[model samples]
Target: MKRELVRNREVGIKSGRSASYYFALWSISAKLVMDFFVPARDLNFFVFNGLLVALFLLLRPRLYLGRRGVALFVVASTFFAALALKDGGNSIIFKIASLPVLVVVFFSIGRGLSEAAVKRLFKILFVEFIVCFLLNYVLSVATGLIRSREFWNFEHANLLGSYVLVMLVPTSYLLYQLSNSKGRIIGFVLVLMAYLSTSTGAFLLSLSVFFKAKNLAFKNIMIILLSIIFVIIAGLALLSIADPMTYDKIAAPFKLINSGGWDRLVGEARNGGGITYLAADQQGSFTWRAYAYLVYGFFIAGETWDRFIFGNGVGGYEIVWGGAMPHNDFILILTDFGFLFFIVWVSFCGWLLVKVWREYPQWFAVVVAFIFRLLCENNIYSYYVASIGCVIFSLIFGAITRASRERGAVRAQASRAVA
Candidate 1:
């Protein structure tokens, strides 16, 4: 009896040690996923490679090689093959291929997380968001004399704002799942951080869409909207007090709006073609973007019948004026590849949307938060955007997939018991 008890104690100790090892790997992998926005070269490279090694060590084919997961893999493999076949030596193929691998890594890691583990991940991300926000605010305050947008060494203020906004989707969702008070408080804090970056896209979506209102009544809706407008005004007022020049920098992109010059925006674009046409407005910092979006619309309108059907071909984004995106995903995808590829890509996205939504249709607000960004910024073709997009989407898919599997297993177990 003593020998049996000793053996049982040894087994329990081994299990405890194994769990600690598993969690150490999980925490490191999750942190690497969280830090994709920090633009330190060797650090990201090390963390990313370290993540891959950890993933390889922790891989379980049963989790990823299942029916729905395999279906996703097949779709991704097909898209990669298609991109490779059409690569005209432009670097789109590399970006295209790397996305799914990143998604798979996150998915593999996230799939194994228990509820407690998932909550711990959220707290880590919550801390990360606050830290980055403080860093960006400090740097912007310190460097106010030099730069228009302070990115805290990421890609761009707007892009980083978008990243933070994306992080808020899962952050808010996870917190909401835990408790409403926690969700509302943290959600507001995050939105305030995003607004400080002056990313109109993030501001619009994160506040107007993701954050919750008290009720569904029209009065509540109006109050929430008015409250948001008030907070924005108040926030900018505070920013102006801290640094008027920084406020000016934040407000420059909207000088057209104050002047009621949106009508003038279209005339600027139709002035000529290409980058020169967009850059015609010497007085306007943002008129060029307005000009470019209009130009892309015209270019799409002028596509040859065959080109319109198939896209300009893969890597065909080079033909874009100076090869920069119109800061629109639909325009970027449709123009580079063609209507068909764009449709396929969009349809697959729609499927994920439906799958995710079916799990909880209320989650559509979180999904639309990023969709709003897609309308106003460079889409997943960007490295930062791709990394942020993959981590969030894969986490949702992984979590949902795990729940689905557990339900199936429970049902199977019941069936076996009945038999």
Candidate 2:
């Protein structure tokens, strides 16, 4: 028994140390790559998921598969039934094949994280943003590689901008919690940088942060001002629509709302034909991507109402969507798997968010960043997104579990003393 206790202590120490190192590395590396350079497609996907797989292997045994596992099994069984009834590659068989691997990775990492590690990870992330932003500015001037809007065009700039906004949330929260005035100022500056980037999603996320801040009266005033500004912009846009030629040279800042301006932009693209045109043609300016996935999900749910009650098998979206993965993570599960999987997935996320909010209300800022990104990008199912999500989840859950265990121990001791 003594030997076993000693071994357990050693294991615990090792786990804590390893978790801290990995967390720090991930935080820094993610910021650096996203900010300075255009992420390579394959590399981007692989790094995110690869880190998750590594985390899972490092932190093993305390797995929490939740209802997702059971749902996957049911979906697999249904797929097998379908296979027995018919014959083709359309069999549910292919869908079930990927579930085991995903479960193993997600649960393993989820069980590994601790609150202290998460706090440290956030610190590393903050430093990374500052460093990367400065470096990007320098590189742009020296090499002129990233100066033109053309270079940062399309999904790359949009995604990177979203990342900056998302990182700002946790960084800002951490700064507020640090009790250092200088640190808070630095965090505030980072927030300013994110705002100035002018990524539409980032701008919206910043607005979310402003509203969620501790001062309710101030938030209300800000909201009123924002509404007035929007109204003014709308009126200008209406005028522009009525007199396209007169407004053409006026260059309205609210060009997004002007159909005439939009037509001109689209026409220019059709006549000139480049990446900008392709981007403009994308439905609803990329927001439509989520709706597309949602529509796809409804179609799947309609077809597999019975089979998907549990799930259509885990990771089934990869097969169902084929080359084009669903742009919405929520829809990915709901449509490809079923209502059961969707409920479980959403419940788990909701629980995590609530817990984070309860313990560290400031972290909600980070959550805003993530949600804004989710609106425009489907990072939830993407390998990197899943990995980061799992790590963050693990850290939050670990903190909650550890705190509960400590409280329980203290209560037990007090009861024994009274006895």
Candidate 3:
């Protein structure tokens, strides 16, 4: 009877392990496909996140739960509570509904980061980006759809372009780390294709790669300089042929591009009558609610403090901004939750940045892209934002955890040897 029982336990363990391996693969593949092809859809988040959560719960006994994990839970709870209160109970209820999905995202990232796995995953991503971009472009041109603005309306293309651009720096760095001729050639070709796509974000991302690689080889600098020169020359040629009315139409956007931060802020403040000029002849509401939250938090204390600490909750921004998410993530946190939550959120970002720097410095391009995008888009609370955030956070946490374990093992070995 004892022998039979032991056999049953062993079989259970083996089955569990096998299930986990398949689950991890499924989660990673789903994430990649969603990221590339269906990024704008909420359903992708639901499917991927559901799988991730199931895997985590099933494997929790074997997973490490540490300080960071505890902190994450606390932060999530505060945000969840804030959402509930802000939305008149609906926000909280929705967050509860979504909790399982968030867990899956967290676990999926954690499970996918073995060193060999990281390299393999990146290689596949690089290939996919190339193939997808080519196919999209070819289809667009062959169908005579390339000239239509509707061709650019596919949100997935924009998202993928942004992803490639944001990842270019890190991808290049990975190539350098691999230090193989084939890796370098493939990386270069991928970057070249990304640039040819003329996705503004991707082009900017390529600049990041140039700066990162410039010190190692003058060739990077030369390529960047040539690209800039070519763009300028092309612009001049177009301008020379453009009608005066066309030139006039384009000049307003140019003025906005040239307006510095302080000038824009001052203009917004002076024109506070529910409208401000974003560019010449282009006007919209320019309320600086984010600035208001920061200043208010500094002045208020107590349950005003709870509001400051926990945030008004998820949809709290709507109360202050008339149904608009705060453009600044920092302000979004302060207004929605409060100062305490804001500080913790910022601290988490700092910790994640350090981890990425230590283990995957090249991936910093994506971080930069996120920051750049945030200047114009309130991405932090969006479904896509949450998915990307959870994945990256899980990856960093896993890397940090593994490093700590390895260090402890090394120290233990040395101590025993000395004894």
Could you arrange the candidates by TM-score from highest to lowest? 1, 3, 2
Q: State the weakest 10-residue window (summed lDDT) of model 2.
A: 272-281
Q: How displaced is residue 150 in candidate 1, in Å?
A: 2.9
State candidate 1's TM-score. 0.73
lDDT of 3 by residue, 215-279 (tens): 32368657757977897567646754863333333343444445554455444434332324344
lDDT of 1: 0.63
Q: How many angstroms is residue 241 displaced in model 2 relative to the true structure, after the best TM-score fit?
A: 20
* Model 2: residues with Cα > 4 Å off, grouped in runs: 1-118, 132-155, 165-173, 196-198, 206-365, 404-419
Report the number of clashing residue pairs per model: 3, 2, 17
lDDT (Cα, tens digit) per residue for candidate 1, span 64-179: 55687678887887877777777737565655677777677667655655455555656766676677667656766786711666555655666767777766655755655767
The Cα error of candidate 2 at residue 140, in Å, is: 6.1
Instruction: Show the colliding residue pairs in model 2.
Output: 48-384, 312-337
Best by the lDDT measure:
1
Instruction: Give the local distance difference test score of model 2.
Output: 0.51
- Model 1 segments beyond 4 Å from truth? 1-50, 58-62, 136-146, 208-267, 271-290, 313-315, 352-357, 404-419
lDDT accuracy of residue 286 in candidate 1: 44
